[model samples]
Target: MRITGIRATPVAVPYRSPEVWAFGRRRGQVSVLIEVDTDDGVTGLGEAAAYPSADIVLAVLRGLEPLVLGEDPFAVERLVRRIELVGTWHHVKATSPAIAAVEMACWDILGKVCGQPLVNLFGGRFRERVECFYYVARAEPDDVAAEARLATKAGFGTCYLKVGSDDPRTDIERVAALRDGAGPDARLRIDANEAWSPGTAVRLIRELERFDLELMEQPVSGRNLDEMAYVRGRVGVPILANEASWTRYDQLAVIKAGAADVLSVDNQMDGGLANLKRAAGLCEAAGLPVVKHSLGELGVALAAAVHVIASTPNFRYANQAYGALLADDVTSGFGGGLESYADGCMEVPSGPGLGVALDPDRVARYAELYRTEGASFSFGDPQALARAHALPKL
Candidate 1:
């Protein structure tokens, strides 16, 4: 069926607690909800985390609308190409997220059309359940220890602590306390959010090695591959590249430079499902495991990630900052509950498509709360919209 219309609504959801990571403190999540309608009366839903505002998301939707309207929704690849062609010269930042929303919607439509689950459409399930890790966020040694204990008690298999808060000694003490609290069973990972320098990363990893940490994520910045390689060589633990590896080229560069042992894939930043699959294939071929990085995604994106991880043959590590972290999520039809976690693993949704349904009422509530006042379309002014519509399709 042909795509008939595309719509976006900006929404904000307040965090249950202030989420303080290496980036900074976040009081709330700003996101945009995307819906694609098709000629066959089928609709698909997607959500994007836009941070400060949803203007970028609105621009993406408006820019893509002309290209997307009247095109077959099943032609996912062609649609992506169209977006690329339009965004090539300007280096449009919204290309990935916009295409992601469309891709997710296509998957949803495909699942409905084929009467199959999205995971099955990809290949098939490699695992029955996906393992997940919890982020402790910024906390003191005692507080972090308590949180780690709670996670362990809650049956979480892994706990990730935020480092690079201040002193390396203090960070070491926090790691030590976490290890002590989590005991030997739970996996412990640290994320510096690219806070350390090459020298500092080396020193910190050397000091933290005594705690038996699992991995250090983005210990140094992603820009300098040589520095990452140096840090990798000096550190005993595996270094995961989060912000560093966004696409196939980035992944290849990291692998060639020996910059990292593990690759963290964030669907939002790394294009959509198809791009993620492409990256995973490359990583699998290179014999590296793919872990989902947190972008404060709600159930919709999380479900997509679960299906991707379940489909990938070589994904070994679990992701952090998911499950019941969001205060409210519209997409929960595919079994949205933290109770699914058992022995540190979460079961992938067995339903069709992304196996989730959007709650219209909840969507409306979020729309009312976080909706920004401005022009609905962001292509240009009204003049640009008319001009774009008048242009013939290539």
Candidate 2:
């Protein structure tokens, strides 16, 4: 069917706690949800992690309209190619989420038209449920320990924590507390978000290895593969690449450089769900496992990724999700809080398309919240912004 129109909504969903990383902190998730309407009466849902910013994502969507309006929603590949090459969005990686949203909506339309779930269309269920890690927001050691205990009680196999605090000793203490609370069996993953230098990474990782880290994520900058390789060689902890592997091209370079033990992939950062699957295959061929990364997403985006992850085999690690942090969701019974997860896994929606529908009332609530105070949910940390903190914090 031909595309009719597209509608975009910006929403801000509060987090149970602020998401802290090396560079900044966000109090909640700000996402742009798009609905693509078809002339034949089929509508598809897509969500973009307002990465960089919502204004940019909305502008990208507006720019993509002429290229998308009359196209066949089923021809996702063609549509995506047109948007990338002809629409000249290939160079601007920041605009990827918006393009991915449109492409995702098309896939949703395709699944609905075929009367099949996206997992089946992608390759059938290699797995019925996708496992996600509990994200323990960066906090005091005691708080981290408490959150870790809660994660373990909830049956999560893995717990993810952010490291790379200004003081190296503080990060070490927090990790120790996490291990103490999460116990011996829980896999603990830490992300530095490209905050450490190679030397610092090696030294810190050597010290932190006592906690039995599942992996150290982007401990050093992702820009230099040699730096990553150097740290990986010196450290006992396996490295999981994040910023280094945003696109399939970057994944290739990371593989060739022998920079990481695992690669992180994100459809929102790339172009679409299909591209995410492509990234997995690229890494799988290199004998590397893939973990799905998030820029903070809601249920609609989460479901879309789940279908692809469920259908793929090499998603051998617990993927990232905001379930542990999101206070509530705009969708029905999916991806809001820790309650939505059973044993740290979300069951793949068995319905057609993305298999999850929006809750209009909840959407309205969050949309209003975005309208009233969207800035509070942004990536900028006011305190961090006020202080002049240099990177690698040496």
Candidate 3:
């Protein structure tokens, strides 16, 4: 069937608490929910994390509409290529979420038409369920420990903590508290978000090795492979590249440089589900494990990732999800909170398409929330903006 129209809705869902990292804080997730209508009466669903900003995503969607109108809904690769080379969005990484949304919707349509789930279409379930890490927001030592305890109690195998505070000692205290509360078996992973210098990363990673970190994510700048290789060589903890590997091209560079033990992949950042799978394949060929990265997504986007992760094997680590942080979701019976994830794993959807549908009531509720208080959900923190902050906080 040919595409008829594309409808977009921006929604804001609150977080249980603000997500604090080195750069800034966000109170919740803002996503652009897209519905692609076909001439044959089949509609497809997609979601784009409001990465960078909701306005930018909206603008990208508008720009992409002309390119995708009247095209076949099943021709995802061709459509994405048109949007990339023809629409000239290939160079702009920030526009990827919008392109990814359209691509995801097309996959949904293809799945529904073929009477199969996206997972089955994308390589047929190498795993029944996908594991996700519990996001331990940056907080005071006591609060951090409390969250870690909550994560461990919930049967989560991995606990992800954000490091790279202004004060290195404060990060250390929080890590220690998490270790103390999470006990010995919990897998502790830390993300520096490119905050530490190479020397500082070596020093701090050496100190934090007592906690037994599962991964050290982007401790140094991603742009400098030499620095990443340097830090990875020195640190005992395995390094998982984030900022260094947003796309397959970036992943190739990271692999060639021997910069990281693992690489982080994001459909939202690179383009779409196809590209995400391509990324996993690229890494797998290099014998490097890949973890799914989240810009901050709700159920629709989460479900899409779950399908691909379930179908792929080298996604051998607990991938990122916002369930531990989000208070509610627009979809029914899927990821939004910790309750939806049993034992820190999200079961792949079994129905046709993405296998989850949006609850209209909840969508309306959150859409209204977006219209009224969308600014508060953004990445820009007034407090953070007021202060003088610089990266590589050495």
Q: Distance from true position, residue 86, model 2, in Å?
A: 1.2
Whole-model Cα lDDT per candidate? 0.74, 0.94, 0.94
TM-score of each: 0.89, 0.99, 0.99
Model 1 agreement with the true structure over 196-282: per-residue lDDT tens digits: 888888888998888888889988888889989999998899999986887677888998998999998766666678878888899
Q: Which regions of candidate 1 are displaced past 4 Å?
A: 86-94, 333-337, 372-394
Q: For model 3, where is the 10-residue window of minimal lDDT?
A: 379-388
After superposing candidate 3 on the true structure, give the runs of residues whose Cα lies further than 4 Å from its correct spot.
none
Model 1 pairs in collision = none
| lDDT value, candidate 1, whole model | 0.74
Taking the tens digit of each residue's C-alpha lDDT, what string does model 2 give over 1-394? Answer: 8999999999999999888987788899999999999999999999999988999999999999999999999889999999989988894789999999999999999999998999998999999899999999999999999999999999999999999887899999999999999999999999998888888899999999999999999998889999999998898899999999999999999999999999999999998999999999999999999999999999999999999999999999999999779999999999899889999999999899999899999999999999999988887776787766776764
Clashing residue pairs found in predicted model 3:
none
Count of clashing residue pairs in every prediction: 0, 0, 0
Better model by TM-score: candidate 1 vs candidate 2: 2
